[model samples]
Target: MAPAAITLAAEAPKLSAANTGFMLICSALVMLMTPGLAFFYGGMVRVKSTLNMLMMSFISLGIVTILWVLYGFSLAFGTDKGSLIGWDGDFVGLSGIGLTQLWDGYTIPVYVFAVFQLMFAIITPALISGALADRVKFTAWALFITLWATIVYFPVAHWVWGTGGWAFDLGVIDFAGGTAVHINAGAAALGVILVIGKRAGFKKDPMRPHSLPWTMLGAGLLWFGWFGFNAGSWLGNNDGVGALMFVNTQVATAAAMLAWLVYEKLRHGAFTSLGAASGAVAGLVAITPSGGAISPLGAIAVGAIAGVLCAMAVGLKYKFGYDDSLDVVGVHLVGGIAGSLLIGFFATGGGQSDAAGLFYGGGLSQFWKQCAGVGGVLAYSLVVSAILAFLIDKTMGMRVSEDDEVAGIDQVEHAETAYDFSGAGGGTAARAPQPAPSATTAPNTKKVDA
Candidate 1:
């Protein structure tokens, strides 16, 4: 007798070439944001500290990359242990994870997901560097990030994104990283600035940006790379959500730039290049989380509000005497909060989540959830960052010596300068050799008849 026909179960999740390719490209784009950030921060600093500023951002790429692979990813995305943090040993060195293993619902391999998230981790610490520009020691900066990423970023990423994490389980809606990346970094910046104090010439010297063109170029790059940041968060190329996010990103960024320029013109009587660059960044930060949730019109509102609010917020440091070097607190912290909270009011419930916002007739429930997420991250980051800064200040010393700072941190810290006026045609043109010391003239008298 023939045996009964055997039935086969549906196939397990398999890799999708399109999704893998999309994620890999997104990772590269996200990686570019770090160097773009280096240029942005570099150009904002005085010439003497330009290279140091660039180095501060660049070093995070090196340091965080190593740490991420070793144990950072596991602590961030590994199997959740009570939702506070992941088990570091679960994926330490990416052990026990096979090349063919797919990340839960996504079609990409687990490694691809890991690397993509690694880019986010790399930039979060670098974002803090802008606040401490020129003042902190390079060695100490390096050490601080290594510690901060471990204590602050890893756990925060888990809280916001990890499965079963408190924020994830609590129904908080952070499509990208409004809370984990921007707010976390911004608050950390403020904390360190409070401990490190102001730059030597804060509020007294001009401290103008050495190169506005460099900053403009950096802003362009950041804007270009942000497509990957927001759209790629979807982890798929074919999803309409990515397209919505992409369009919202562009629209919001443009609106924010225009709003900032208008505000600058009205308040300061001039629309400056610096304002344009900064406005663009503020828009980028504001749209990061809300892009996936809100409509393009809502994005315009969010961007415009963030632009105006952050422009005003930048002045808060001067009033409060915090000396936030590059306005990280102003742009990132304020913009992030604006975007995250606005989602509760503007979310259309048309994307991944079904939760509608207040304007969409969902009421104030989502709004309150957003407030809780924002407040929780802000408080946790501020306290932890302050403790970390204080400990480092006590142990290894966070600031350069006064002499080193006054003379220029680039030469003292990195033994290199961003520019050199010692070239053959440089150095004040040699004063034309002083015309042979006016040989025909007396020491104290005017020249005689030649």
Candidate 2:
């Protein structure tokens, strides 16, 4: 083992109050991302399916949190077993893990690291909900996330982030989670959507977003929360690299938003709010892995490319005959791949890692390594996610009945409606009128003067 790795393993765990506090705050920020995602997805779905969309994202918070504490963390971050996955039940339920012991090289306590990672685990599976929106059974969706997190996310996270994990050892530069979170979730979205099939009126019906304002709000929240997602991956380094990551995140997102707007105006003849929000998200995704390694200029380039490409990519569902309800395949999957692969050309070697990119005179070695990492995660996630979706579909049922789907999932599944139009003579509202206006008392009192 290298000296740094040896030191990481051998050092006694100690606390850094600064790092601990920073990580705690970062965890909270990351936690907000799930709800942010909920709004982002919720707003894009039809009014009838809005709550269900929100629920899908929210449920992951509950399921993954419990699972992570129980064994998800252990499977992802536990002692390495053959570089495939982590092992050891000791970390399950956080058992036998000392409170004072810091993670290998970090100054924060192990518990803090676990919780920080827990936030990532929660959101990754939730990212898939958008593609499967409007048609899935809520119970089945919950079960799918639980199983998917266990089988797919846990092991993949281990591969990308865990010590002695294959990609980690192979030098893949995923600063935050381009491969582990975005690409992984995006690929899984494609797989599940393939199995579940398209929405009922996917092409013929005009399934425009019920509320773009809501989506804009959600996108704003996501942009605010992503700072923690990307910069906090530094884990309280409080150094120049973290600052650089922060700046790059902001710059890349703005550039992507602009790029998306430009593309939209050119292609569709209008600058839509949806385009702006989606473009911002694309920038955020593109910069996630490369932000810490690349310069601000590189960040802009990455964001612009992702913005244009993803905007173009979203239309692929129509061409390819797939119904990616919210374009998860386009924005996340494509954006993630762009970010991870671009690191090969833009990396400055000045950040946390000393690996330089081809443009920086490092050659194509890093680029090929990046391709390997992206391809491996994409392939694994797609295959496993498809099998999981298929098994769930075969055994219990994945999609709701056609009746339930068209009648609105909120009413059919949750027995509640997102918008109540009863007062205005709309949608299932009671038509009870005022009790005849107190017939004897008030009718003529004010008319006496007339």
Candidate 3:
């Protein structure tokens, strides 16, 4: 009887309450970034759409959070039947993942891990909306996010991060989400931008930011929360590797900020606040892919390159006549590719850790692999995103009417105002507003010929 009982005993894993607590906090930290994005994007747009811009990020909190708990997690991280996607496990609807269960070889409660990742899933799609701002109907945007997550993000995440995922099997290392988050969103942003067409009077319009101060504040908040983002990828405290990644994040961000300011001073004769914030974000995106794999020096290089390339890429839309409103493609897509490829050259140690590049005598093998990986991801993302956008447009329509767009999405869609310049203490416009001596606002005109 004793022998039989021993045979029947389940293998219970030891649990760590402290790790669970740390991870739960990390999840909350990542959640804060969406609002950080709200302010970041809000300050970049015209004053009329300030609330609407922020609401795009706010809406993700409601939509993706609920979907992630229901099935997004299962589809994203569950056991994969092949290299492409995962099967529905009992985790769907979070069934049987109780307060006491283990997850992904961690000692923390599974629920904590699930919620932590869910926040990442929620904010990723919201990041892309900046590329297609000021024109999409609110309802159309909501539906597009839902379908995009279900079809595009989930499968790509499974391919990169899930058990038996193709990239994981191929030794493609992403500490937090260089490929899944940045490159995927970047390419998808391009797809939607092409399908949706340019914003009204893009090149002709001066289209200056209504509030640069708000954008700076948002950048500060995002930088603060990123400690959780990169470190939390380790999913615990007291982790030396996580500590290294944390340090790398700060180092890269500072370097990129300095690099961007220097570039601005060189080109424009003055350092702009917009350049500082954008540079910080570029550095953050570059460090994200290579954070766990490279050294501090590698991080600095990645950040510097990302800063320079992204600053240059922002001007491409003007040259090529595509309106990438907020430089999502410039910063995220270009930065993501730069980091992923640079790691192939800079990686140290041997076996899984040693991904040497052309300079390191590993020859062009690793570089080619990196190129293939980047190309594959970009091609797949662009094609699938276009298809998804087309479907959504065909079924539910994609853009708001020209009249609704002119009126501001806040008034038409959410029925709210971001500011009250009226004297009556309400949101009404001032009846007898006099024009300022100088026009701080850039004129809304078509700047480039299409």
Candidate 4:
């Protein structure tokens, strides 16, 4: 090749509109998962706190977007600092990069890459809201996620995905975010819940989902959006890896849902809607880190293992005396751990990298790498998150007043309610008066619908 031609090639990768368009769609899909999460969690809480639950997740979209644009991206993807963090002055406020400049050698524009990652940051902390439901003060919860994101999430994202990051350097395989997104949020959830304590009634109240249909719908959205979440991490489908990730995602999720239902049926004697929903999420979480690295058959194993493990782990709070309002710890934490570790056992050399898992004759090298990645993210997120929560709890007060909590957080915090129990007229206004029935007392009881 001519020197000028080589110089031009070395200057930048050829931009591809196809890849950029695909990424834009994926970013939108991932963005949709936040509201999907809101609905899923909203339906799980009592009617009294339904809107509050939804708000907890919805608020992240606003909080994290501002943060990401300001400095979160710089800290996460900038030039590496000791493999622990990143810092690029130009990346701060995203002012230095050109709109058309590509991300690392990827075909998509830098703006597209930043926005895609912003979606991940937004949803990661939102995942913590489920474990703190019904008891936390909304403002306190907001502040905590803010501080937690600044202190914990940014550094961790750098470590997991940034160039020269320790995990990236160590050859730890995280195709999507088994550790960065799921385990990070799960551990943080456990930390905060420990400080805030349980819901007001705890074991006495029969707190059940207000609407399983909403939960199912939310789960469906998450599943749909997750195609983008898992596949887009590869950034494109050019070499077919992203397509492989997409297929694996579906296969594993289906397998995990079945595994969870089987566990539920054998253990509880009935297949519940809740079981199906939870199972599906467990599969998604498990496959997220490994999907790009494993075959579809391996994905089934990862999903089934995560489903049963998370199902069994869900009851630990009752036995161990902690209250995780919606099993975030069980599903995200356990499933994340299972999926991360399984990458050591299931990864094939042909998928994402030449490093095979134990089953593929790759030995324990990758397994130990997986262990390190999982442990590092879990420990850091847990400790820093707990400190942030405790500080918030001590200074500003974290939980709502017991009276307000029992009365419903939605009304106390947001001045609204999810449902109205008043007689048919839906507004907050008082009911109109009714006239008395006269001597025609044999009256209106014609087989009416109650």
User: In the order shown, what is each candidate's alpha-carbon RMSD?
Assistant: 5.6, 7.8, 4.6, 4.8
Worst 10 residues of 3 by lDDT: 441-450
Model 4 Cα RMSD, Å? 4.8
Clash counts per candidate, in order, are: 0, 1, 6, 0
Q: What is the C-alpha lDDT of each candidate?
A: 0.91, 0.92, 0.83, 0.92
Better of 2 and 4 by TM-score: 4
- Cα error, residue 347 of model 2, in Å, equals 0.5
Candidate 1 C-alpha lDDT tens digits along 1-450: 323322222344568998899899999999999999999888888889999999999999999999998999999998899989997574798887888889988789999999999999999999999999878999999999999999999999999999978999998888889999999999999989999999887887778888889999889989999999999999896659998999999999999999999999999999999999999999999999899989999999999999999999999998999999999999999999999999999999997588889999999899999898899999999999999999999998999998899888999999999887776473565645654556566374322110
TM-score of each: 0.93, 0.92, 0.90, 0.93
What are the per-residue Cα lDDT tens digits for candidate 4 across 1-450?
A: 999999987877767899999999999999999999998898888888899999999999999999999999999999999999999998899999997898988889999999999999999999999999898988998898788889999999999999989999998888889999999999999998888888887987678898999999999999999999999999987899999999999999999999999999999999999999999999999999999899999999999999999999999999998899999999999999999999999999999899999999999999999999999999999888888999998999999999999888999999998877765554445455657778786475532211
Q: How does residue 237 of candidate 4 score in lDDT?
A: 77
Q: How much is 214 displaced in model 2, in angstroms?
A: 1.0
Ranking by lDDT: 4, 2, 1, 3
- Candidate 4 stretches greater than 4 Å from native: 1-12, 423-450
By the lDDT metric, which is better: model 3 or model 4?
4
How well is each residue in 119-151 modelled by candidate 2, as lDDT tens digits?
999999999999998899999999999999999
The deviation in Å at residue 448 for candidate 3 is 19
RMSD of 1: 5.6
Candidate 1 similarity to native, TM-score: 0.93
